[model samples]
Target chain A: AKAKDFTYSNRGMTLEEDLNETNKFYLQSEIAVIHKKPTPVQIVNVDYPKRSAAVIKEAYFKQASTTDYNGVYKGKYIDFEAKETRFKTSFPLNNFHKHQIEHIKQVLNQNGIAFVILRFSSIEEVYFLEGKHLLSLWYRMEEGGRKSITISEVQEYGHRILLGFRPRIDYIKIVDKLYNLS
Target chain B: AKAKDFTYSNRGMTLEEDLNETNKFYLQSEIAVIHKKPTPVQIVNVDYPKRSAAVIKEAYFKQASTTDYNGVYKGKYIDFEAKETRFKTSFPLNNFHKHQIEHIKQVLNQNGIAFVILRFSSIEEVYFLEGKHLLSLWYRMEEGGRKSITISEVQEYGHRILLGFRPRIDYIKIVDKLYNLS
Candidate 1:
């Protein structure tokens, strides 16, 4: 029923797609309530025709001030940003904006579960990097260190989510494990 | 600095504007971290020019599947939708959609803070209707009750939020009082 109205492209499950499906599964099963934030667009011009819906004629994409996704699970606030890179060895830090980093820190200060999901699309590997480690890595970059996190560093700092059939990404399993939610 | 980039219109602070400013105040004061979700737009066409940003050529607004404002406040997930009605005596229920009601219920089931901020524009009065009361009211409407909620009914089920100078709405003050937040 909901599928009829969902008009987004289905390009064989990118990280966002898999996470969206996983969130949907969680929703249907009453396990959690999560959603991806819509892309922020700056509307410059709008046209209103008689008896017709308003159409945005000119708009530009704006950088998101917060992470891509946020919600609640088992009374815990959940927040994360998802990104995929084709690089084989590392995930580039440039994929994240400064405001997003600051937003993650704010969530952490509020004792919320904050993290990032990085995908190495070349090898089909997805890893969840903890927000603490991300902050530290971002600080290192600010101090003129490496601008990317190696695959091994991600493995050490984060957990790998296994792809599933029903939920697609099964990220809450990792969330449960990460937060010791039992 | 952020004001320069915040390109949205300012028309003497509508309910949404007041809420946005209030959320910004909470964020800056380190009292809470709430934000209004961006308006969802369905993109139909995009134009990318050489050495320039991609411009959205065609887009249409889509109904939101969740509440407008949400964030983490003192480790708890906060969610709500704010609406203003000019009807003076009653606020029409049609301002809320089915998905929004369901979204509030979902947030409640997860033990998150969920509610609606109703503004009686003509009377210059605002009320914070609790989600539980909202659900009960919605059920009554489904059972063929009044389509609008009277001011007295709202007062009985919710708290009156005093408009503040700094935060504009100061809704969290009511939240703290309602939840006995320490």
Candidate 2:
């Protein structure tokens, strides 16, 4: 089922690059308008070069952002964070931050679509877990539950996102099913 | 009526800062999830110290972003650009790039709320103009029309945003009226 043409171009691309490429395809096709927020940086010093663009001489990477991607899909607000975990047995819940968890909860309260795209890099498979379900496990962990969620647990709770030629991840198909979107 | 408390607090803050502060207030109150996208920078060089955080040694400012702010409001995706013009007569259309205009158009096509918050910095008044109205003026300009929109025209086509204490701009009230939200 793996086509040579599809395999060749996406061979060495990182997960972030792959998602960005897919997002570009989606935008060009008028399917969606998701965009990854730029990494925040605390700029300290800058030099204004004469008759040219300003050069930043000193800066530091700022704190972690709220989420990676967000946009409108079918008149509904879509927000998600993507993560790739190496462990095949379980996914470490520590990958998400406390503030990010709060952000997802807020999105749900606003009646928007909120979820996370978790990629098992070893297995080369991705899963979509709803914010509500993730929140439940997160609270359990705070209450002294296991620090990681087993692969089987994810298999039962999350939707498997099949890879495709065009948009690659095709997460929207899962979104349609999850949100009952027309 | 310039209140002493409001003046003292917001004295040195720029229009952008005021908006950001208002956004923070909105987010904290769970009223909306709007955020100003960080200024994008192009990294050139980095210094990685063994035990400390990596420092950006060289970088340059990137191109202007699509819009200044975006997020979910009342289950509807909201996208907008904020601009403050010192001109009392009209807003120079040059303030907007071709791509920004196209972005607002895309937001409209997606059934999301798309608008611009224009501040007449001199008079300390702001107006909310719909993307559709902007497009009409943009197209007219492309066809060799006026390079700027008159204040009278804006008063007719745009909604005046009242100032407030906590949220500052209070643009959401205008949003409710514009969208006819219950």
Candidate 3:
């Protein structure tokens, strides 16, 4: 394989960039208003230099308590986490935090649309796994059954995302189909 | 008045803190799932010490492109920005950006609940101003009218939030009434 051929995951862009571009497109096209929450950081120190912007001198990344992306789409609340895994056979459960699982359950209880977007980077494939499915998987894990959902299981329970140029990955189309927006 | 009396806005805690507490209470009680988005920061440089967590060496705060607080309530998409003003007579228009205005408009168009939580700190009064009302005020400003929405106008178009111990500011009750959630 040519070295450049390896860059086929949405043309060398990670799922994050693809999602950002998708969100930007969504906003511009008035399709949706989702946004990835800012990377959480714990600022320890800052310096207010003369005639310059305040500079954070000491800081650390903090784990997000909620999903990465959230917004309203067609009168419904949308929430989801996007992850890229190199593992070919399965999507690992360790990519998620316990609180995040709880958060998804809470969102489901509130009747909000929540899900996980998993990108199998090695295969350049993406899937939209619903919040309920994730919770069921978590429960199964709690029962000491399986630590990860196999790719075949994901294929059975999740919708595959079709990538495109306009919105990069058209996840919203999958969402609309899943949630019956249309 | 004693110096300690100065700490009247939710016992010296800022509106942000108060809202955070309120959201936490709501989450715990299964009333709602709102959260203040983390302060946006543009991370520039980072250092990875062998045995320590990655340290952000340089960063700067970035103006938020959307409203701060967003979540689900009674299956509705809720989004809002909270601001406290020391101005006695009015809430200034400069507290919002153009894109935020656009965001609120788009959210409203999608049939989501959108509003601004305003605190007139001098009097310790907080009002939930509807997104449509805010858009009207912004339009008025664009038409060479008032640059700020007077307190009277806020009182007319907004619902006053009662401060409470458990939630700090019971804004959800106002939302329930305003949007007929209950």
Candidate 4:
């Protein structure tokens, strides 16, 4: 799957870039409106030079209390988190935090669309798993079950997102299918 | 109004701190799940001094493309932008960006609750005005009308929020009235 037919430079681009491109495509095509929340950073010190832009002298990543991406799509609120892992066997549960899980649950209780986007960075594969499925697995994990979700399980329950030229993550098609959108 | 019985605080806490405290109160008091979106900064240079923290050496403020706060409350999706003004007569239209207006319009079209929280810092008064009203005013401003929303108009359609110890904004009470939640 990795070496079959790939010619694009996955070069200096981070996962954020891919997701952003995907969102841009979705917006232009009028498919969905989604965006990655700005990375939460705590700035402690800054230096403002006379003729230069302000430079951050010190900063730290602040723990996000909610998921990364959220927006409205076709009369429904959409929210989700995106994670990339190098491991092949499973995606680590530690990638998610307790508060984020609680937030997603609350969103679900309010009849909003909540999910997680898992990226297998090694193989360049992405899967979108609904929040309910992830929650059930997470609960089982808490009860001394699997600590991580296996790739096979993800494949069974999640939709495989094909990387495209525009809107890199075109997951709205899957969303439309799951939500029965016309 | 300046010489009223109201007290003043010059603690000079950052905007984020004020919002965090307000959100903490909101959460504990079951008011509304309102939060400031993390500040958007474009990192041009970064230094990995140690494994613990990555220091950003150079950064610039990126124009925000969406409204700051959004969440579900009482079965309705709530989206809003918080603005603080010192002017007594009117709140400037420049406080809201074009994209933010478009985003609010999208939320309204989806049947979600969209509004603005305007804070007159000098008077310590806050008002919650529906996005539709803001958009109407904004359109008029574009057509050579007043470049700001007058305090009188705001007083008419907006709910005055009396900041308290718990749930500082206390806008959820207004939400309950708007949505007939209870």
On DockQ, the candidate that comes out on top is: 3
**Candidate 1, RMSD to the unseen true structure:** 5.7
DockQ of each: 0.70, 0.79, 0.82, 0.44
Better of 1 and 4 by TM-score: 1
User: How much is the lDDT of residue B22 in candidate 3?
Assistant: 87
- Deviation of model 3 at B31, angstroms: 0.7
| Candidate 3: stretches off by over 4 Å | A1-10, B1-10
TM-score of structure candidate 1: 0.93
Per-residue lDDT tens digits for candidate 1, residues B23-142, read 888899888888889999999999999999999999999999999999988888999999988898888999999999999999999999999999987667789999999998888999
Ranked candidates (DockQ, high to low): 3, 2, 1, 4
Candidate 4 DockQ, CA atoms: 0.44
Q: Candidate 4 residues B27-129, lDDT tens each?
A: 5555545557888877777787755577776677678888988776654567888888899979999999999998887777767788998988776677899
TM-score per candidate, chains pooled: 0.93, 0.95, 0.95, 0.85
For each candidate, give the TM-score of chain B. 0.92, 0.92, 0.93, 0.86
- Model 1 ranges with Cα > 4 A deviation: A1-11, B1-11
Q: Model 2: how many Å of interface RMSD? A: 0.9
lDDT of 4 by residue, A1-182 (tens): 33223313455455677778878777666666677899888888888889977777677777898899887677567888989899987899989999999888877776778899898887778889999999999999999999899999999989888776555666787888998975
The whole-model C-alpha lDDT of candidate 3 against the native structure comes to 0.90
lDDT of 3 by residue, B17-87 (tens): 88888899999999999988999999999999999999999999998999999999988999999988999
Clashes of each: 0, 0, 0, 2
Q: Which ten residues in a row have the lowest lDDT in candidate 1 chain B?
A: B1-10
